[model samples]
Target: MRSSRRWRRLCGGRNSMDHTKQLLRISDIAAAAPDVLRYRFTAAEGELAPFLPGQYICLYYEIDGTTTGRPYSIASSPREAEEGGYYDLFIHVGGSFTSRWLGQHGTVGTTIRASHPLGEFCITPETPRKIVGISGGMSVTPLRSMVRSIVDSDTDREISLFCGWDDPAAMLFREEFTALARGCDRVRVRFALAQNPQPEDKHGYFTAEDILRETDAAEAAYYLCGPQAMYDTLHDGLTAGGVRPERYRREVPGELHCPPYPTAPGECYPLTIHTGSGTVTATAAAGESVLVALERAGVSPRAYCRSGSCGYCRSRLLSGEVWTDPDRAPATADGVFHPCCSFPRSALTVVLPE
Candidate 1:
């Protein structure tokens, strides 16, 4: 009886917590839409890692000699791990991870490694204004957790979710949004699809006009997560429609294809990178990304979010010509770089800061 009691206590208490943290196993992969698949991961012994709303986790994979790690937002609500013991994520296959993620089936017993829980995109008491979120396409991942938390916490503050996508078929978490809109009197959802529209739909890309027509623009704080094009479109549309810059709160995707603002005087150029130790120089061409050239020349720089979001490979430019993607960690006017995405714009020499 004593042993059983001890075992029960251990299993019901700290041991359960310990078990809740073993990486994860791909329990199920359900197809959400045409290109989207909901990859479900569960703890080995039916436990889950404790996580928070809006925080993301890292998915590790080895493609070649270099190990690539990608950070993905957990679309599932925090309650899943805090209350239950399963972690669910909605991933749409594309670009970088498309071939790998699609080829690997997330069936039961498939093992995968992931981080505890990470990210700064969440609700807080200090969020002075009522919630207002604007997302585009796959950007819905992080907001899904936030919206679910808002409803689950029973916060009386009003919220409006304005989401835009390419089309109806590409929309994610449709059922979840529907339930949220139906369940919370304080929650309102406005969905826009460029290709197709319902009778009361807002059409084409979301314009500043839509923001003005739908809700009070200035009174609320804004949260934006979306593709680069959507961001650029919204920036012009909002300013033209009178939405001040201060009201705009945005968290860029870990990777960006284009800049939201105007392109600078220089785009990309050839350069020679000088390593810090012995001053080894590697030839890299303009327009070709820094990381790409370095890898080609057999130089390895540590990086996680190959995109600018993770400052893993940020390097200082002793002196040279390089174009850095926007939203990178605070680089000096002297020129710092996240080599993973930095492209050379002039034949310059820089010491790889690692």
Candidate 2:
């Protein structure tokens, strides 16, 4: 019956609006690095949805009896997605719900719920002719897509990628990147090892100085994806070196760790969350985010990247003021905020999306 329903949905036998979520079956899995696995998923039927090379798809999982979602970057190129009817995702084992579940239950036949591709971290026609991609650790997933897309499309853009890994043995897609460079004259690849530096790899981190040495920072467009500390360091270094703020783009992997808001004496506020089930009132600690308050009340709103970049925990600020982390805050009009990085300044009434 499930297969029939899915087939009907694909064949336009029923209302197309009925299927909001796409069901994908795991077709293959391989170890990409130490504790990192590459998974390939295919639509149950029909062609897979088209996506930009660097966009991500949110995968839904049931954790501790609660359904939640985590976004994973598509590591495959657009050509691969269209020709192979599949998408590839590289996941690092970080003890998160999705990682734990994949470790135990990921198999050739396991089915999963996935949202359509989303996000804006990709190359465009407006992108500068010279591009620099800096990736650290497992954050290379999206860059892998971008590089593959550039190569497969035979784009005229000159691309340089500086990728770092913890160790030589833990380098994800090292061989593939090397081969890509060998095959493409327009591409240059560099690797850095943070620990136990190998003979072929650079000894230290990929710093801003290295970027300036590779290309004119003022004239090139840069794409950075990795930890927040890496982003901050490079952002500061580049800007200090005369790189314009609009010349670079960045995406921090997973949730953001925002410092506690400095509150005045006796400034703890109460947060009222309005959901479909009921209104739950919780204490918003001096430095805690509204999401934390909701979680304290046993209310789980759908969240993925806890960083405001994913916009997964966006809620309407019905009343009262909230403070957001300067780095992760969204540029929005009043009455809208992302609870993942927002802390209440006063008693607040928030309406969560259903």
lDDT of each: 0.65, 0.77
Return the TM-score for each candidate structure: 0.74, 0.80
Give the alpha carbon lDDT tens digit for every residue of 219-285 in model 2: 8888899887788778888888877878888875575333464566655787888999989887777
Could you say which candidate leads in TM-score? 2
Indicate the TM-score of model 2.
0.80
Candidate 1 wrongly placed segments (more than 4 Å): 1-22, 44-52, 97-102, 236-247, 254-288, 291-304, 318-320, 326-335, 344-354
Q: Which candidate should be chosen as best, given lDDT against the real structure? A: 2
All candidates: CA RMSD (Å): 7.6, 7.0
Residues 216-260, candidate 1, lDDT per residue (tens digit)?
A: 666766778887677777777766665667666676566543434
Q: Report the poorest 10 consecutive residues by lDDT, candidate 1.
A: 12-21
Model 2 whole-model lDDT (C-alpha atoms): 0.77
